[model samples]
Target chain A: MTASASERLTLVARPLDRQVASLSALAIVLALVDAALPTPLPGVKPGLANIVTLLALYRLGFAAAVWVSLLRVLGAALLMGSMLTPGFFLSLAGALSSLMLLAPASRLSRRLFGPVSLSLIAAYGHIGGQLLLARLWLIPSDGILYFVPAFALAALITGTVNGLLAARLLRRWPSSKH
Target chain B: MRLIRPGDVAVFTLAALTCGLVVWACWTQSPARTLSIRQGGALWREVSLLHNARYHVAGPLGDTVVRVEDGRARIESDPSPRQYCVGQGWLEHAGQSAICLPNATSITLEGARAYDSLSF
Candidate 1:
């Protein structure tokens, strides 16, 4: 039995790790695509890469989702040449906050919440974290808070769209419960 | 499986409430009719945006010119390096502002439609 269990871990873990890497790669590509779009204001992006993270959280669980998110943020930051810069720090803050918010959310109501609510929560957490970091480290002024309305609106719209997309993807997920 | 679960509906309702509240707060702002200039972190002067006038204020680096025309304020000229202040162009919106870090001078629109908040 021990031997079989060990074999099971080896076989299943390998495939899962490969799946995480592939998802991370897809998220990285999305991030690069988002970067190519022109933003009318700073800190405004569709954040499409988060869809992969949401999928990972639902399918592969929290740790795998975290790994995918970090890999995407790091890989994309490196590719965009923003590593170790303020932009990287902001992205890192946003990703970490979303992961933190998603952890308990997934456990609380896996059957009820679904992807839409989870996506909305994570999206708000992400933008809130980035804005807080920008206020504290990047610009030391209350003047920046004026943009919260715009940012909040953007977050709501993008979160809903991303959530819908995630829900669709979740519906199409293979039925054989992994 | 359904596209949206009961929980998704609840979340959507809550999100909608939050968005509506934000929109109301943002749009319900007083219109601005005055322009305030600050130097060295102090209130240097306040000018009426209703009148088309130009004022030259002494800045840390040199003289900076602020112009108000047709209910809009803008930094017409500045002797600061990099010309960043001048690039800000016209400030017709309530929360719009221009700052010259080198000269430590800033022009911010004020009055009825003043900002409920400012983004850094």
Candidate 2:
């Protein structure tokens, strides 16, 4: 039996909807895990959910990736109960900057550096945003220096992990050839 | 394609250098012997001849009390959901500070003299 064009479109739309829903769910889970995970050092987070952002960038393109990044930050802030404070603003700034840098990088270099490098770039961008926001909004004078070591440490650890995870996910669900 | 470009290297190098300068500044600053905390128009707490010690300040309302003794410091405040500051542990060195936002309290250690005295 030959399916009508509209029916085929519906079939396609259904998977797309499911993907969006599951991706959003994944973002929230990552945020919870990020808040719950204990670190030996204070102010350091693993950024485990960044893998979703990278994956989205590769598979769903830039707009979808941006949405994922924003959702993750918002979800994390809500989970941590820092939603309306300086911490939320800081996270938002970091997410925006990180995605801004990553979206372009993913488009240009996904074939070469793969997910790990993208993750590293995104991590660096996020820290850069936080530092900039701290200098601008919170402590204008010396607060920026306080978290340098911790932020650097986070970037190193989280970027590596996110990159590795992104690679694995990509391999599992290889991009469908058009 | 090389993901790490020359520009990335340069930016990272500059960042490293800047970080080194900050660490150096932190280490060289001396400890303050006398300090004062002010809220609004009144003195909140004033301490003189603050010795090198560790102190812990904890309370339900985020009101932080500073305990400094023999190179140990502890900060106790209403644990916000994140608890980032609580996890920061005791800050013992001079030129260090811990902030508890829930209580709007901040503690800083400085060189062993008042700012006016240093000017003389």
Candidate 3:
């Protein structure tokens, strides 16, 4: 009986932790890849890591998706030596704001809300959160508003691309029941 | 499930409209070229953004040093207990502001936009 109980924790807790950790690692790698890409603007990027987040959301659940995003931000910050900086906070704000909005939208009937819509919502929330934080703390100026149009356009494009990629991956992903 | 759904198109269209609206609104806004300083709730002075100088405004506490340089302005120092105005850093764009409630002095960047909510 004692051995079986110990096995339960190992089988359940350990696997979930490992799964979340692996997903987070994948997201961190994608983030690093994104950083290496050149862009016309400072803040605009493809946001490739969001693909993993969408996968986690669709596969495991929203809680697992949250874990992946949180770990990705922390791990990427440590790797990039941006810990506790404004950049780090901006990333965190973006992730949390996106997830906060993504949660309810995910609950929408699956027939209508797919990866594309969720991705679009997440992308917009991310930029909105970053701008809000910048206006409140860092820049504290209306100049930040000027960047909105550019950021929104970028989010729209990137969100669509990421959604398509996620959808394709989902087609091949094995939907094994836990 | 289908990769592209009608709901996705609706979301995209709505977002794109919003993007266009922001672009137009931002484009129409004239550059903030003036800084208005008020003392004890009355208009005291208006300065051009081109000026590079420091001002000493008398308030309840003491002289609050307002610095303007390189097309930006800031409350550099103050006699107040908490230096929140000083902490606000710089005022660069239209609608930016810093209020020194303890000193009864404030500065606002004006010259563009119709809505006051954006300033907040």
Candidate 4:
């Protein structure tokens, strides 16, 4: 009876798990695409991948957003063969720092903040975190500050554009997905 | 159905203002005052960028003429086949660098606040 009842201890995937998996997969795809997209300047990226995280946060809650974002970073790194590199750490730092501001601000007043504001905040946080890490471990010189303004400007543009996209996506998200 | 809320304007204004402040502050770093030249990965000399000057550096490829003026430096002429160093235009920022790899010579801009030791 025991052998029949408990054989192999079958695992069941919860709805939250499925949601997180699908969302993370989408994010990772975007991250890879962003990586392939060329920029005139080093360290400049459009960061369209974070749109998935924003959508997940709005629909599935903070926990789902966190899982989606983290998994996306890790999975993309694995696919890109950049795991454990300094570049990987930079991505992780940016993701975590942005999330630090993202959930609380979004939960505070969704009516006021919406997606654009949150995207801008995340973009700045991402750049700030990467710059700090670059100073501490990579460049190891005040010369890194030379890049602050350029990076900040890039973040502003990308953040706003991505945020707008997320807003439109959120507005159009399918009822079936909900 | 609003594309941008009132709070979105606040966020945009705040972000733009902060970015402008950063731009002004970074751009205002006292102009670079030193130009360091290296030959074969060794320190050749440090020239004053505050005034115009010219120096000829000899290498395996031949002479490389460096002209410094208007707080800017450049490889006025290089004997390297590609002329890539000469084509680099101007070196203006604190961390700007031009490496004439074939000629075994390089130049870097060094400001009061920051100096880039890495040249490539």
Q: Largest TM-score belongs to which candidate? A: 4
Give lDDT tens digits, candidate 3, residues B4-97. 8888888878878877887777776656788888889998789988889898899988998888888899999989888999998997778878
- lDDT by residue (tens digit), candidate 4, B3-118: 56667778877889889988887766546779999999899999988789999999998999999999899999988889888999898877788889899999988875565543
Model 4, A1-178: lDDT tens digits are 3467545776799887998899999999999989999997777999988899988988888888889999998999999999999999999999999999896777767667778888889999899999999999999977787789999899889988998898888878753554
Q: For model 4, which pairs clash?
A: none
Question: Residue B77: error of model 2 in Å?
Answer: 51
For all candidates in order, the CA lDDT equals 0.85, 0.66, 0.87, 0.87
Give model 1's DockQ, 2 decimals: 0.38
Q: Residues A64-116, candidate 3: write the lDDT tens digits.
A: 99999989999989999999999999999999999999999999878776788
State which docking tier applies to candidate 3: acceptable
Q: How far does residue A43 in candidate 2 sit from its true spot (Å)?
A: 3.1
Candidate 1 chain B least-lDDT 10 residues = B23-32
Off by over 4 Å in 3: A1-13, B31-120
Interface RMSD after interface superposition, each candidate: 1.7, 5.3, 1.2, 1.2
RMSD in Å for all candidates: 12.7, 15.5, 11.2, 12.4
Candidate 2 C-alpha lDDT tens digits along A63-169: 77887888878877877889879988988988899988986776663344567767777888888898888888787965456566667756866776777788788
Give the docking tier of candidate 4. Answer: acceptable
Write the residue-wise lDDT of candidate 2 on B1-120 in tens digits: 333444444444554554466555544444444444433334566555346433334444644555655544545543456655567666555455556666555565555432322221
Model 4 stretches astray by more than 4 angstroms: A1-6, A174-178, B31-120
Q: What pairs collide in candidate 3?
A: none
